[model samples]
Target: MAGSCAPWVGSAYLFLQSTCKAIALPSLYENSQKKPSVFRALKLALADSTGSVNGVDMLKVHCSHPHLIVQLKFCKQENCRHFLRSYREGALREALQNHLQLSLAITAVPLEMELKAGNEHLDSMLKDEDRCLEYIYREKPDRLRDEEITELEERLKGLMIHQSTSNSIPVNDCTSLDSPSLPCPSQGSSLSPQVTFIFQGQQFANRTLTPDDHQKFAKLVSKKWKQVGRSLQKSCRALRDPVIDSLALEYDREGLYEQAYQLLRKFIESEGTKATIARLVAALEENGLISLAEELLGLHSNEDCS
Candidate 1:
């Protein structure tokens, strides 16, 4: 009976050991695969968190220094404190000199409470000084203090005096053509009539037109038309008669008579009344499109009669 029991016990132990090995193998494999990936990610995060300020890795310094300081501050373990102190003091000093500048690196641990509060009063006073400086240099006259106003006024007076002196050209000096006695080209040329067009509130004349003037003017008109069209389209509505009329006028100014006529015709078809037709006719006649204007007028008269 003892021999039989011993053999049975040995077999049971062998079975248990095999089952434990089967269970433990996968977990060990998984841990081996997972641990390296976790370590790599942690390494990447640490690398990214480190910021270079004055060519120093601030995050690494911040992390490592705190750990060392905490060990020194607490000093619970005698061996730990001694090792940390010795390492910090000099063990890697020569190697770390290039990476950490003495003036910029944290040499001592700061009290947590003091660091939290900072120098609030000093910061407040500096902010106040900045505000005062901004007030003195303020562009808005209404915001200026009395002293600032007086200083600015004196500066302006000095500027005006300097300008007056510099601008005073002698009449006898032939080289100084900016004198009052010297006639300006525009004033001199005003004796003769000049062909001029006013487009977008700016005056353009034949004399001022360069060789590429027509192309430049056409490009400008195209740009303006595109801008106006975009604005009208964005409003999600049909273009108004006045906008069409303005565009027609711009096209006419650019010598795009066909485009101008087409725009006017579309305006007339959509929004023209008797008064609008009259205005259109006057505009067309003024722009030397008499035949077109007469045709419009005739159409209007026929409509009115009908």
Candidate 2:
């Protein structure tokens, strides 16, 4: 499950992985002529899995070109459509290497697809590893204003409390970095953690992005930062949109921004301001990074949103 995510199609055998890679047979015919027939069978299998009859019109997959953007066109239904899923070379390799009877791993594109055609980026990546990485690191833009913390004394005075004991509210004990547990409210307790909220009698944490969140996120992305970074750099050039590019993660090292986690954590932290979790989710969506965003939010998008 580490390398896998929800189907590209809301409903299963599909999101990023071409059911073609589920090429259940390890003895897949290397003969070029036979590949098409196999894909047709795969197309049918995918339709069955997704509960659609004749859904996929075309399923093009090549074992050799594992890095070429993965795509499938389903028989259009109401508004059901298909998309180009770009995978990191690593994910594609894993998909190919997988001989699991019923599983395949795939990575999804984390950028706007309409950028200078998929082929262009592929050609650049295929042609020159040294050449493409010469991107000039732009100035990291800062936009959000930091919220000022009000002193407890000021708040106590503002409330006009004349209690003999200190009126200051104790800080929530939930910010413990040592343990990654979310704030859970104790039942029947008079006081709930400051960060806890009750909804329909169920207590949940009003989680915010924190340094610990950054560390956790960094650990998750650290393994494949290069692949993720490469995709980000290429898309940034195409977007030229100042806002997203500014918040985009840096692949190459720059001071504390040396790792993928640092770059991504910096992105989430908003330069130490009161970081809004929505901002990170919005930025990822704008960049067409549905999978990563979903992962952060602890979800698999079941609704098929075009």
Candidate 3:
């Protein structure tokens, strides 16, 4: 209180009293020595994490676009807008954007009220992402075809990129492993040592994907790696014991996507370096996945072409 502004301190004290009372956490109030320091900490947290003493509609968005409503239990975004490092779960954010075609937000939380709220609402949150992927893979009556969604998503993405700041590459934004991925037909990524595919009539044709595309491609493979590994095994076994196999590409998968996404992300770093669209296609063909091969190529182009 010696160096702090008196009026601001008094206001913060009252805010904390109300918030602490609402939270109903005995330890928070009982710790008398820490009350001032805790008040200061909450003040900083309110600034950084968007917690307001006065009830602000922190989760309401000022939008009328076609959408669904979602109420998040953990309202971590700055007043629940853009993602914050405090949560460090941007992958979930990207997954909703990429897979579910859903925009995620904080959902009308007043922030402090949820500090020690009941666990009932916590169950509503998306904890296990893998459990819900059946919606994508498994059939549904009203579900639109992947091709239609892909094309529509592409158009929307083009519009979004056009409206975005030129200072940053949209591709440099969060990459979703849950996002569909993999190759184009005819031309190859062979023009550059690091590239594995190319689009002849697209904006990114001249750009080099190299190391960036490598990681993305590898993660795509590893995402459905059980399937990829099985297909590779089939292709390898088709030759009645080939000289090399996906087993040859065996890796630790302990970094990058592996660390960021804590799924069964097993891969070797060199797999991306060694991979080619042609080689993957050949393997798929050997395993009699010609249609799947086409889909992979198609999705891959959709990724980098626009």
lDDT winner: 2
Who wins the TM-score comparison? 2
- Mind giving the per-residue lDDT tens digits that candidate 3 earns over 150-266? 444345445335432222222322233332222222245333233222221111211222444344444332223334444544423332223123323333445334422221122
Q: Which residue pairs collide, candidate 3?
A: 59-108, 182-300, 183-297, 183-300, 189-197, 253-267
Q: Write the per-residue lDDT of candidate 1 for residues 34-117, one digit (tens) a residue.
A: 322222222221121111101101111112221211000111122222222222333212212211211112232121110001
lDDT of each: 0.25, 0.32, 0.28
Whichever of 1 and 3 has more lDDT, that candidate is 3
Superposed model 3: Cα runs more than 4 Å off: 1-154, 157-212, 219-223, 237-275, 278-306
Q: Give all TM-scores, in the order shown.
A: 0.14, 0.29, 0.25
